[model samples]
Target chain A: MVSTQARNALAALAATAGMAAFVAGCGTTSDGSDSASSGSGGCKAVSIAYLGAKTGDSANLGLNMVGGVKVAIDDYNKAHPDCKVTEKDFDSQGDPEKATPLATQIINDSSIVGVVGPGFSGESDATGKAFSEAGLVTISASATNPALTTNGWKTFHRVLGNDDTQAPADAKYITDTLKAKKVFVVDDASDYGKGLATGVKKSLGSLVGGTDEIQQKQTDFGPTVTKIKASGADTVFYGGYYAEAGLIAKQLRAAGYKGYFVSGDGSLDPGFVKAAGSTGAEDARLSCPCGPASADFTTKYKADNNGKEPGTYSAEAYDAAKVLLDGIAAGKTTRPDELAFVNSYDQPGLTKQIKFTPTGEVTDAVVYAYTVKDGKIGDATVIK
Target chain B: MQFFFDHFFELTITGLALGSIYALVALGYTMVYGVLQLINFAHSEVFMYGTFAVIWVFTAFGAGGHTSTGGIIGLLIVSVFAAMLVSGGIALLIERVAYRPLLKRNSPKLVALISAIGASFALSETMGLRDRITGFVGLDKPLADYVNGARDNSSLPVEITPKAVFKIGDYSVTTIDLLVIITALVMMVFLDRFVRRSRAGRGMRAVAQNPEAAALMGVNAVRVRQITFLLGGMMAGVAATLYMIRIGTTRFDAGFILGVKAFTAAVMGGIGNLRGALLGGLVLGVAENWGSAIIGTQWKDVVAFILLVVILLFRPTGLLGESLGRARA
Candidate 1:
């Protein structure tokens, strides 16, 4: 009886496998026609897809990018009514698994001329290959992993400086300005965080007191706090987003560590202060490539978003969207034309002159330092 | 050796505080397993709901900053009660929705376990998507704010400041630590004594031993199982409040790893044993901290599982052995 049951199960599995293969073959043939038609004949209403987490832990950053994209789209439509553009937003929730299908959808959707972002490095890394293969040009506002540009993706571009550019300023602030004899580094063990942490470590050299890694979404930092306390480093530089950074900062302070706590742009959110509490976030500094949006842009954004000022990458996101919109306005409708246009694209933007290297990095992006004073992110000071 | 000695007192206090939370959460897992002989994987969601309950309560009251001692005590009492009540309700709901139907149909234990895993995901994802749900309901202003606040680590305004009560060596004992450790001990002791000398507790033991026998002996087996989940969830609720107070922040998935550790504690302390849960939690917590101190922080979780494996290898029945249902036999 058992042998018969096993044989039947194997037979059923083989039949199902055969059926799936037949279906998949049909699916590919249909998909090829769909992409071919969309690629050649652009839709009457062109869309710039905004892809990122608009609802999860990283929603603050993603929403800001969306807001910036919205403003750029609106500005472009008002200026050029004859060549109108629309925006398509996809919420990846800052998860790579979610971004993969969304990337495919964006690629298959022929109406999408360009992308404003895959706001996070993880999502960009996950979807870059698909976008590159589909010849979809994605101008990321915030993804800054140095390796993202080196992935041989011809259609990928970012408006913000990568870790390679940002880390030198961070190391300088830690070693020269703070002048700490000893420094400890912590990362969330992501492609972005580890890259930035390692870069800082290389710059600091012998001044590096200790180094540690943490997982994303990890809450309890009791052991990590103890380890940091024992390290006796005068400065602690954390390379992670706000959620973990705030908790670590709070726990570290509660444990009576009075040293300087520095973090990267990933932690530059109002939520950081809210998470760290007033006392815990005291004197903490956040370094980022993008600063506050321009005064006029800030006022306009506040009006648009119920008096909510744009967050960390809002200015850069606006710049990124502007770059793509400018390319679209210049009659770069098809994916290949837009990709080529963005490659040689040079225009003044909200944050900086929007120009990309052959590798798709912003050539003249500047890093800025912002200190947390009185429980708020203070005005940015340009860090040379 | 010097590092260990220097940080000994600090580590010990931190470990004890951490252990107290594990013990509280582990009781729910242990008690449910004691009666059902199945892991209610959704017990973690019960604890997570308790954390949000405290957040909702505190936020509703606008509780923030340093409160007066009396105010702090009052807030703690109210929040703890709120957490317990919400968690208990959710636990009962889970058992009713996820476990009772399976029990009635006499389904396999694996099916019930799978149901519990589904319930766990459903609860956590609901919390994660609370904002979207609330917005859909058209209560977008304040309700959306509350739900979105929980999307990430919602840092509660510290209602009670952790003042240094005393110093042992270079480590100072804070009031929050004392509160967590003391509250956990009190709850555990009360639970221990109650289980040893209560009608319901006896019913629980009878049901655990043999449901048919217990049903024959005038104890409602189903009711006893529900009560067991209730008691366990209440304990977890108290654990949640203490956790939020000690950690000062709670996220939607906060209970996951901690729940795993608590389950490991339950298994380590002899799955069905009451005292074993406490012993297992304290031992696991201290050992994890010490292991991290020695090896590194990233390997802290690795150290915890390794210890669990080593202990189980030595004594498969666990350190204390299963004794929940045995009546002095």
Candidate 2:
């Protein structure tokens, strides 16, 4: 065995060396971050970027979008191996602050001809200007904020219905459909969550009982639960992502709440079931601008994803990726040409009538109300 | 004000439970500061590792809704020991890797602090990248259950319907909350005693007061440091286990905010004083609760910091007074 003094000296040397290495390198210990944003040296040099929370609260939603883009890229490359396009993954963690730098990064990478998402509405709002100025096309699968369309970003387009259609339908389902007497509206204080909450509360009007706003990534809901209990509401509508929605639902149940739990598209994911506990998640209602995937797309996605089902916005993201890939297939190779192609785009895609109004919203998009039954997000019914 | 009082008991219980977790975590910060004269920021990761250990044990047992109450108790015992062992081991490793070399070279305090910060980032990011790391070794598929969403929150498999053991006012005191508070109080008491009574504890106290003197008096500085980290880390493990039971979720970055809060608790209680950590944590928890009730829930974090600033301005030594070195041994 080495002597004590020698061991001490060796440890000191090792730690100092380790410190040097860490200080010099940035903290990306994972090989998980995909290759460079830009790929070159070919006729198919243009790349499509998937932007959203690849790893943070509600990452499932972002990963769903990424997976969709992946399927599209994999299928396209398989068909044309000689001229295969590349894809980029920019994980924003669904935060606007994080998305800003990523938006700049995406813009700097000239090969990123189009973006599949900035995922949530807040980041979409934050990054839309830069992408618009840079003439980069983005088609979000799940950003449903009505204000996003009003922002006049020529580069902004979405495959799903906006929250303008969703919130009212959600509110109506809570009031007229569920026939709730009292409603308590809660928001996680996101651009997406708050906007939907406002619409939902307005629609509920006299039926609304109380309201509260929580932060993203907040774990404890004790005080909030007390407030909700005091309100004595029959239904609580959560305007937030699935993670927090699941938590609030779990806490509500723990505190002996027997009311209905409702939430928007942000809270509509398989993650909710895992988070809210199987029993607690039952009967919880959700509204989304998406529907069940077609049999073929589900088969393809499951085959590639180890039998993982396509979560919320997966099919729409596929359609969004298809738009970009189709533009590329038709030789609209440059970012500007891709934007031009999208401006006049219309097709019967996988999820909807793949067409955009001047504001870049799909005209025939439908909103569906879903319920959690037996720990699964149950089948959807067209609510609007 | 009225709403707060109306729900005072419930908030108090909730606050206490949360505060206890903070207190347990704070002890790691306070004790490390006491002896090493350095804040172990990676102490949070020590707690985080404990939390993951707790989840892994439960996953291994396949503990869930169907788990009998007796089975849960057995699982809880096993999980606690597993968490303690992992946390304690990690704590010792951290001291050896992050602190020992610096101490050997007589580095500046700032450099030491930076070293600890680097260690902190390295530890948390390494956990966040567990999936990719496992993938490198072709173990990703086998370890998918543990590492599938390394950066995301992984919850306990159990679906618990928290049963109220008692009632106060309109609130029902759940068994989980009671267990969290009691467990924390017991650990704090035990740690306080250990620091005051045991041989290793005496060595730790001697070092905190006068490292050179303690060294002259035949106390092994390295061993003292290791013991300090071990005890502090075990405390964090207890906190982690309770956190798993109470909050039922843990993320890779879960430690960041909680670490900040626990550090705040250590400071508010008078950093380095054991009793101060307990008082500071409880007060911070209840104060935020009451503050939220009066103003709004969104202002809770703002209230916590405002209280900290007030505490710092008036009582800089914290509620108990700073310096474990100077405290009665």
- Candidate 1 ranges with C-alpha deviation above 4 Å: A1-60, A76-115, A118-138, A151-155, A324-348, B66-70, B140-142
| Tens-digit lDDT track of model 2 for A187-210 | 988767888899999988999998
Chain B alone, TM-score of each model? 0.96, 0.97
lDDT of 1 at A207: 92
lDDT for model 2: 0.83
Instruction: Indicate the residue-level lDDT of A65 in model 2.
Output: 80
Model 2 spans with C-alpha error above 4 angstroms:
A1-157, A295-297, A300-308, A318-355, B326-329
Model 2 residue A35 lDDT? 27
Assess each prediction's global lDDT (C-alpha) against the native: 0.82, 0.83
Q: RMSD of candidate 1 to the true fold? A: 7.8
Top candidate by DockQ: 1
